[model samples]
Target: MAGRKRRTLTAPARIVLCLLLAGISGYFLYHCALDVLTTFQLKEQIAQNKSQISELEDEQTALQEQKEKLQDPEYLKYMVRGKYLVTKDGEQVFKLPTTQDDS
Candidate 1:
């Protein structure tokens, strides 16, 4: 009871200080929310890219195998015959309707 009362901010000063603090807090909250959203989006994009990369790698492997097969004359002959319906000389080809759509 003997100590002097501490000087406090006036009503207008207190209001202004509170308003400034609220503005700063809101700005920080908005920025933090934005960061979280951006992180989520980027993670999703990374996952999609990783899956795409794996798919492309698998396709590349398959294409490499096909290329290897093409280097062999027997496989090439079989592939051409099967895919293009080409035949050797004096060979007969029969065209049949497929059960499923071939294309």
Candidate 2:
């Protein structure tokens, strides 16, 4: 009996060893999968942020161009005349109704 005990693991001991190994493997796999998912999510967020930054930069460029245009006297005069209906001396003011075609 002593020699037999030394030669092989008992059935319950074998089961416990297998269960421990499986548990440890499962734990590591779960964490690895979680980390991979987190990395993908972070990468996706970074891509979205990059695209948004590019859009904002394009908008900033457009706004800068508009600001420069606003500084021009002729353009400013045109905008004022069109938007506020301002007229120079001896200029006839006409009120025209805007027609919208909804197709």
Candidate 3:
């Protein structure tokens, strides 16, 4: 009987196969790690943005209340006097002495 021929991979073929598998695995691992890091960063940003949004909303409410107050005649007069140093008709204004002028 004739001897059977054995089929085997050459050394170069084995090396190429190993390198291809390693490259594919490395690519998958790299992308997975990047995705995890990106998700964490996005979650942190969302949390920060939510806090900022709440703070801005609170400020907006306060500003709305102040707007309502300013629409009133009495409050508007008071605010104008305090902010612009304006006086109403026949209203005497008092000025405080500055600390630097005490010398």
- Candidate number with greatest TM-score: 1
Each candidate's TM vs. the true structure? Answer: 0.85, 0.82, 0.74
| Per-residue lDDT of model 3, residues 6-86, tens digit only | 789999999999999999999999999999999999999999999999999999999999999989999998888987889
Candidate 2 residue-wise lDDT, 10-69, digit = tens:
999999999999999999999999999999999999999999999999999999999999
The ten-residue window of minimal lDDT in model 3 covers 94-103
**Can you write out model 1's per-residue Cα lDDT over 1-103, one digit (the tens) per residue?**
7797988999999999999999999999999999999999999999999999999999999999999999999999998998899998999999898798779
Q: How much lDDT does each candidate structure score?
A: 0.97, 0.97, 0.94
Model 1 spans with C-alpha error above 4 angstroms = 1-5, 100-103
Q: Give candidate 3's whole-model lDDT.
A: 0.94
* Runs with alpha carbons beyond 4 Å of true place in candidate 3: 1-8, 98-103
Task: Name the TM-score of candidate 3.
Answer: 0.74
